[model samples]
Target: MSADPGSPSAAQVELDGVERVFHLGDSDVHALRDLHLRIGAGEYVAVMGPSGSGKSTLLNILGLLDRPNGGRYRLEGRDVTTLSLEEQAQVRSRRIGFVFQSFHLVPRLTAAENIGLPMMLAGIAPRERAERVARALKDYGLEDRARHKPDELSGGQRQRVAIARATIMAPALILADEPTGNLDRSTGVEVVRLLEALNARGVTLIVVTHDPQLGARARRRLLMEDGAIKHDTMAAETV
Candidate 1:
């Protein structure tokens, strides 16, 4: 377990006066309202809220997939809000990893290829990419399934591959949305434990889950309501 919300530093993520708005028919919808929060490096945090609480919107903004209508987003002391679309995509590809509830593996690609996809996109050297992919496959216990396609693997195995793929780029941050949503209880726990292992190695992890039991496992739990943070509690670190 980590500390109880240890003091955030320049290395941490800062969201200052973030706002997101969308137009719905003839009206305006405020998805996020002047949200300000900081998440330190190596922290395993969970965000919880109902369906319409702007959880996905916030996650998208954090992941750099969507831009905020207003506010500055600084990642590792660099202002990224003003970057061009291509630059933002590059930053996201190089700095962030994403794991969604639905394993987004391409049906045509093998497990090994899927794990190496990010590195391939980043134009990493073939030998280095191969090395990382091998390690990732072995680390996630997918070596035996390296040649198998997603359709052939079990749910747990597919999720494992997804996790491996997410971290193979050695991303600074991992954003997981309902990672365990499609798995059984035992398998879900296993998946989460694998994620925690990565966090233990210093990658910032933020998980969005609707399950209280799952959220409670994190050191910091953020409760959201109506597109705003209702409460954020730092629990005693679990030994």
Candidate 2:
């Protein structure tokens, strides 16, 4: 998946001839078929599809949580498909961030601890990690909730902590899987705005959602069906 020759910015993500297959018992299920996609920096993309349409599979591959059985994935001009598990983990930690519907915060960790987990895992110095976590807590309006555990926070607060944790490394890309699925309408709207704000600040944001309303908020939309991109708003706009 190459960037358009005339495009201004470089592609942040590229997938070419990507294929993902899963074997269950005696059958093989094709999760993604010849999937090709290119997303530029600072773009806001929404991936929407029915169940079993490979939306989750696509997100997994993008986040390096899973690999495609066939094809190439290039991130920031580097072909990551060939990278080993350790190498992929390194890239994932430094370049990609993930926000999940469930928040996925460690139950025992406080909000500040959760936001600092990535830096801690990457072996960042304690002083630096503490400073970054403090900044994140303030940036996300979680300063007062710093010592509260996940179970002690509200839905919106929990999601804010997850987002702060995800972006603490200043990743080039943010992969959000149903980020607002767990919140009520108003809270979900707030979470979506926070994510959009990140995109506004030049972070590539890709969100997977079942809500049409939520999907519509993205600048570009990819509609997938049967393991293939059925519609691309960007392509449509160009025509």
Residue 204, candidate 1: alpha-carbon lDDT: 87
Model 1 TM-score, 2 decimals: 0.94
Q: Which segments of candidate 2 are over 4 A away from where they belong?
A: 1-11, 235-239
- RMSD (CA, Å), candidate 1 to true, equals 4.3
- The C-alpha TM-scores of every prediction are 0.94, 0.93
Q: Can you write out model 2's per-residue Cα lDDT over 24-51, one digit (the tens) per residue?
A: 9999999999999999888899999999
Q: What is the clash count of model 2?
A: 0
lDDT tens per residue, model 1, 126-224: 998888788778778888999999999999999998888877766788899999999999999999998887787787889999988889999999998
Candidate with the greatest lDDT versus the true structure: 2
In order, the Cα lDDT scores of the candidates are 0.86, 0.89
